[model samples]
Target: MMMNKMREIYGVVNMILFPEDEDPEMLSLELFSSFAKAKERSEEIIKEFIDDYGEDYIEHVTKKNPVAVMGNGDVTGYVYIVKTHAL
Candidate 1:
């Protein structure tokens, strides 16, 4: 049998890819935010999007957006969420 070269479909992404010690299906490169903090951020950021755009802003932008990052996370580089139908 011949060996094929492995490809980095996600590219040289700086963030941790999925199938990790935690959630294997998808590696969450985002820093864990407290409930209150998340709520505040949602209000500050998404509220504006909803007002400027519409209530469907989150639904439209998040559906298969393939990324979730935080400016405060260690994933301080070009982070990317790899797409996969399998685990």
Candidate 2:
């Protein structure tokens, strides 16, 4: 008898925008099969920001696992973001 193996799913990439005076906003970018892919996408977003702003406005880009508390929460599987100012 052959046993079936389960496929692992990696986290997602997100882009977060922080305005100078307004509230911050988040957008779900994409889901990747591996962390490497997710990281790459995150970097790409950062580069895009630099290109647009002519400077590095990013605060941080991180990979995080979302946890559920009593099944009541805004659960985003794996969220990554490039925190920047003024957009």
Over the full model, what C-alpha lDDT does candidate 2 score relative to the true structure?
Answer: 0.43
Q: Which candidate gets the maximum lDDT versus the true structure?
A: 1
What value does the lDDT take at residue 51 in candidate 1? 85
Instruction: Indicate which candidate wins on TM-score.
Output: 1
Rate residue 70 of model 2 by lDDT.
41
Please give the TM-score that candidate 2 achieves against the real structure: 0.29
Local error of candidate 2 at residue 11 (angstroms) = 21
lDDT for each residue of candidate 2 in 1-87, tens digit (9 for 90 to 100): 122111111111112232333322211212323566978897998688778765533332343333344435655455444444674
For candidate 2, give the lDDT of residue 48: 83
lDDT of each candidate versus the true structure: 0.47, 0.43
Task: Give the per-residue lDDT digits (tens) of candidate 1, residues 1-87.
Answer: 122112223321322453334542223223323556787986898578678668775565556445545577555444334243443
